[model samples]
Target: MTPLGVFFLSIGLAVLLGTARGSMRRLVLGGGLSLGVAFFAFPFSRALGFLSRDALDPTLLALVPVFPWLALVPVLGGLVWLLALRPQWAAWSGILGGGGLALLGLLAQAQPTQLVRLVPLYGLMEGVTAVGVGLGVFLLRPFQRGWWSLVLAVGLGGLAFSWLNTQGHLYLPKMVGYYKLLLPAPPGAEEKLVAEYNASLPEKNAVLKELGQPLLRPIASLRDLEGGLPQEAAEAGYRLLQPSQLQYGALAIFALSGLMLGGGLVLLRRPSLWEMGDPKAALILTGVLSTLLPAFEATEFKLQKLAKGWPFLVQFVDKAWPPNLANPEAGIFPLQSVLSEMLLTVEIALVGTFLAAVCAVPTSFLAARNLTRGSAPMRVVFAIMRAFYNVDRGVDTLILALVFVAAVGLGPFAGVLAMAIHSLADLGKLYSEAIENADRGPIEALEATGAAGVNVLRWAILPQVLPLFVSYTLYRFEINFRVSVVLGLVGAGGIGYFIKGAMDAGHYDQMIIGVIAIVVVVNLIDFASSWLRSRMV
Candidate 1:
């Protein structure tokens, strides 16, 4: 689609969405944002050498082989829905629609040759695609109007765009893939060349058998034929066909995206649906689309490449399976192996959670609002402690692992430190909340008896919150173990480190072993932790 066409299309889509949702604000927001995106993103992207005019264009099949009568079902259904609901028109519309269908069926049966000819697949697909779009939009249950509006608008725009222009295909459900692949267009001369060769192959092979020569190989594609075919085959007008792979480039992605989006437009037209939601959602959605559409161009997000690339992924999966538990390089038999690495990973998680819990138990009392109240100095400490927790939590553990890996060198020690530092903040926050929620009656009763502050806390707050602290610690231990696995990927030691080494050396079998170990150990640890937490807490 041309930039100008996209620009207008965006605005129209936004407006339609607003109308469907019954929100004027949505209409304005969607239209304005869509126009802004189309105006700035699409054209400038083209000018900046990000996309060509046809960059978004998926190859549209000009004609499709859907028998034209099949298209009539939904069209008639829609017409009946639109016109037959009225008290005055219901009977007449039903009669006319049903009789018209019956007559069309009779005509097709009478003249099967001409009446059954291929119709424009685009027209059939337009309704079918729109219906697919509607199904996707139907995902809303407790339907929020704002998000629904955004979806319907985009779907309407896509279904409309398929008619006016051809930008690349968005895979939905082979709905558009059907257009990409099965349209009624005849094979090009290049394709016909291969077809001709294959058609003649049986005859040639039979002759070869009679002459006591080797039989010709069956041709699946142009590549199957030998260099320039035999000289006789070439002279017989059977030069190697152009690669058929080129035809698949447009249809590469699955058509799920198209089915959902187009289906939405059809649903909106037919369903007389309305709901309330934030209109700003439409504006937000449009802004995102503006950015993402351009990003798709910049990133060249074509799924078609997968057609040629899927073999590599399949090959990797095949090699990676049946995890190798034994490693001869580590040691013979069961002396040292993945078992050692797995044990180290558990130690890292165990040590990190232990350290964090030890520190947090004492420090969290100062951070709790109830404990720090009634003293200016304690309040200051509370603010400082809370700020520290927030700052520490904000810094991700993996990033901390990278820093520690550089400073401490690559080992489980680095992973231990990263997990401990991060877990301290997490445990501190949970512990403080538990402390703040402790019952006040015991502390007051103890304090009234002239007990020291420390004694009051020991007798009252500690007893109340200790079980919760243990529960929280067990939870943190579970999380820390998982984090440690990731830390190993960054050279902070454990099974992640072993896995990374195996992957880098293309020992997928060994790598899969590490992955399986991590999974099995994590599930076991989680189950054990949950049981202990339930029992102790």
Candidate 2:
């Protein structure tokens, strides 16, 4: 009857399903039935005030009915319980339940003003589709059990989200029409009367307050409002104007979003490889189809028709361009400059690793029991070293960088010291493990040959532990490279500094290029380290 009651009843039924012998199948059916009803019915209930109540906190009340997808909490709670307590049901439940909640809440909030809110939902849908397509293509025996369940769970969830988004009525006054689909006005009816009703609403005052009076002025038509341009912009002396064509383009864009959204779902259900049951073809098809579908729905060409609509479509059209990578008249490659910054990052990592290795090896020997022996005095010494190692490691590299940066005033030196300190703790642990696992036979033989304590370690322990020590050092080196990049976030002089700078300037292309450079540099270091490890082995 009520939205809350309906949601609770659904949960009660789900619990009953969990008790059944074939629990997962029952859960699948029960969950679908409960969520399916609540998805559409809840919106209607909100409109009718079935769940409406006066608010204790007035500010929070504004966020409730306008965003009722909160019913998804129980669904998610059920899935998590199923995952941990009943692994068999986890695959389907986790994907489907998590996906449904995320999508339902997302689409319910999709007013013209809230379109940007769907970005993360779109991202989730993309992720779910990718995972489902991956599972369908790969038939690895070890992973098959978990993968199939995950795919089905995510698929069901995605479908629930898509269905709910399309079914709900737009909450913005009836005169504004739904955002995604434009309904035709009744024949011989005056559009002006509808516009007048829309102007009288509290929402118009709210919009004026948020957007400012000047921005809302000259909106004589729905086309003027949607397209964002006023007619006779020069004569009216308005700061911004949108052509009529752009308004239609905005409408087309929203319509295309719905189609693109639907096409992605259809692409997931179809099988591309019947012979081998390969899902790669299906996956590639989905990727190409979903990505390209929006391209055909271009709105930029309509910018010249500003009499009826907004110029927002021009923004999207500019995004479609490959980008003007040429220098801004300076004969300089901005990309190359960013790439050079990444080279400096590699330098910082290498230098820091070398310094850390030189310090960590001796400290590690102090922590190792083999070097100290089974004596109580030696154990106490080992304990102290271990305590010191953890303290050094426990504090994050960033804090260390901040501490050193404060002392030295922000540069690579602070970053290098931070990496060395963090590396000391990490390398100490690995070195101790290597010593613990070392062959005691060689150590015993040295003792039998009348070797002294230091001689035994030098002649027997060092030879056995050397390879392992090198491995740990190399691993720490890789970690150091990553740490150096992070350190650059605090002006430690690397690609991170450049990235932060680019982000601050709103230069996304430069930011992307910087990120690409960082990835390349890190990969190169990894490859070189692997080659070195091969030689060591």
TM-scores of all candidate predictions against the true structure: 0.51, 0.45
How does candidate 2 fare on TM-score?
0.45
CA lDDT of 28 in candidate 2?
33
The TM-score leader among the candidates is 1
lDDT (tens digit, per residue) of candidate 2 on 1-537: 322333344444433433442223323323333333333212111111011121011111122233444445445544443442333443444345534543443343343321001001123333444455545545333345876766665665566445434542243132121211112223432244335535565655677788776334434444344432222221222211111112222222222222222222222232120122212332343344334434543534433467444555465345424433547686856577786778788788888888877877777777887777778898899999999988988899899999999989877888888887888788888888787888989989889989998898788888988988887788788888888888888978788887787668766666667777778877887898899988994
lDDT of 1 by residue, 428-471 (tens): 99999999989999999999999998998899888999899999
Candidate 2, run of 10 with poorest lDDT: 48-57
lDDT of 1: 0.59
Q: Cα deviation in Å at residue 179, candidate 1?
A: 38
Residue 83 accuracy (lDDT) in model 1: 51
lDDT of 2 at 323: 33
